[model samples]
Target: MNSSLLKNIKTLFKDTFSAEPVIIASPGRINIIGEHTDYNEGFVLPAAIDKGIIAAIGKSEGPDCTAIAIDLKESYRFSLKEVVPVKNGGWRNYVLGVVAEIRNCGKEPGNFSLVFGGDIPSGSGLSSSAALENSLVFGLNELFDLGLSRQEMILISQKAEHHFVGVKCGIMDQFASMFGQKDKALLLDCRDLSSEAFPIDFGDYEILLINSNVKHQLNDSAYNERRAVCEKVAAILNKEALRDVTHEDLLAIEDRISQANLQKCSYVIEENERVLKAVEAIRNNDIKTLGELLFASHHGMQHLYKITCEELDFLVEKARENPYVAGARMMGGGFGGCTINLVKKDKLESYKKLISESYKQQFRKECSFYHVHLSDGTHMIQTTE
Candidate 1:
């Protein structure tokens, strides 16, 4: 936990609302593997990371809400009854969406004051949006005594993104943010929202995230388009989702769908299998196989799913060229974001320096690096009066 950040949020809320507030630490997430397979009812290996959003919230004296984005130095005020998305609202929409979804669940939420900020770097493919959403929902649940389960809270978070934020994201981000345990990666089945936690031991290698530092507008639209293609292909095959289609099954009907759709379907099918294999690899302590799976996953994303941007590809390629890197792949709803790399712990600094210089020369812009550990999901911190 960031003690300084938590203190700042508490101070901000007290200064704004003139009252002590309930605090929640909602963690951003990193997927070890399994990228676009979430919505297809496939598998994903996601872990909540140490960096995330901290929200301090309290009930308003009246029926009005005020939220402050501490990091952005912005504030928004709204009626509790009129929980609508703000036009051109970036972060406000995430908060409001949570409130809206909670109301949809037939729970009455009073007006509240919110102050939130986070250390999770934006556009780094670390699910900060989900973290923020979860923080607000979790905090609101506590403040209102809504009696919502963690499972129900995650669904509200997911719907908040879909309805208010306009991102048709899958439940993986919210689930991982809500349920992740420390030092473990969740093998989440999107089909039933069930997960098995596996100990994430990379031996001498540690997880490194290389931020390409570029976010194209194509991310959300491209994500929606790809999801549509998956659904269409699944319907054509008469399977419930791509998870039900085997490699041979996809190959059998290769002629029926467009080549583009074929590639998308093929990647989803293969990627789901990779996730299953990844769990086994972890079970066997085969880091090499795990690393190879990461590389293959990126290849599928680059060629088949067609989501990698030049900056992202450059970072992954740089990791591929490194002897210290066991595996590398672009993480998140790619256009430009971070590539999750498994790097030798001893060579971590040198590798990061090399990649930094190389990426600067290649792109003429600075790329960021984050060394993140798996962490527990969203939960409250005791507040001091």
Candidate 2:
């Protein structure tokens, strides 16, 4: 939790709305492992990070609800009666989607004023959108006494992304953002929406993120294409999802599908297995094995999934060369984003300098670095008068 961001939101809300506000802190998330496997109903290991969005919201007197985006330096207004998604709505859609989904659930929430901003960098793969959606849904639940359970709130957040943002994202982001706990990573089963939290005790090591600061054009199209391939293969194998297909089952149909499609299916199956092993490794306090799995996961993502960009590959390779880094892999929907690394606390500065310089020289663009702490999920800070 950032005190400065909270202070800024309070000041912004008071100056704009002239009423007491209910404050919510909704955190962005980082997946420790299990990339590109959630839609397949495979396992994912994710934890909420300290970086997130803090929002101040209050019930207003009319049908029109006004919102101010403190970071974007913009304002928007909409009517509660007409809660349709706007074309190219950007952030507004997230707010509108939450309200729209609430109404869809047979609840009538009145108009409200809102002001929000966050420190989570866009396209850094920290799941800022999920954080924003959860913040609004959680805030509205509080203001209206919506009686929404945390699970219900996360589902609402997921639907908001699907219906309004036009992104067919899996439930991992919203689930992690809503259910995350401090010093723990969740081994989430996408099929059942159940998770086992593993306490992260990386004694002398820490979580580090190195952002490539580049989003390749292939990200969106490639994601859809890969997902379709997974679905197609699952249907061919007479399974509900790729999660149900074993390694031998994949091999049995290898002669039927293209080598490319085989690789994609193999990656999902293998990544799912790796996630299970990762949980056991955590349980036994085996950080080295965990780090090795990170490297292997990156190899599959790079070669089989083909979602990684040169910038991302370069960063992960650099991390591989450093003895201090236990494990590193490109996280989120690849093509460009951060590589999650576990580095020895002592070498944090030197590793950052080496990677930053090498990345800049190779790509001629500056990359960013973040040190993140595991944090709790979205919840109320206070209602200030």
Q: What is the per-residue lDDT of model 1 for residues 88-120, given as tens digits with 9 covering 90 to 100?
A: 788888888898999999998888899999999
Q: Write model 2 residue lDDT over 81-183, tens digit each, in one string.
A: 7889898888999899999998888888888999999999988889889999999999999999999999998888888987887776788999999999998
The TM-score that candidate 1 achieves is: 0.97
**TM-scores of the candidates in the order shown:** 0.97, 0.96
Which pairs of residues collide in candidate 2? none
Q: What is the C-alpha lDDT of each candidate?
A: 0.90, 0.90
Best by TM-score: 1
Minimum summed lDDT over a 10-residue window in model 2 is located at 215-224
- The CA lDDT at 286 in model 1 is 94
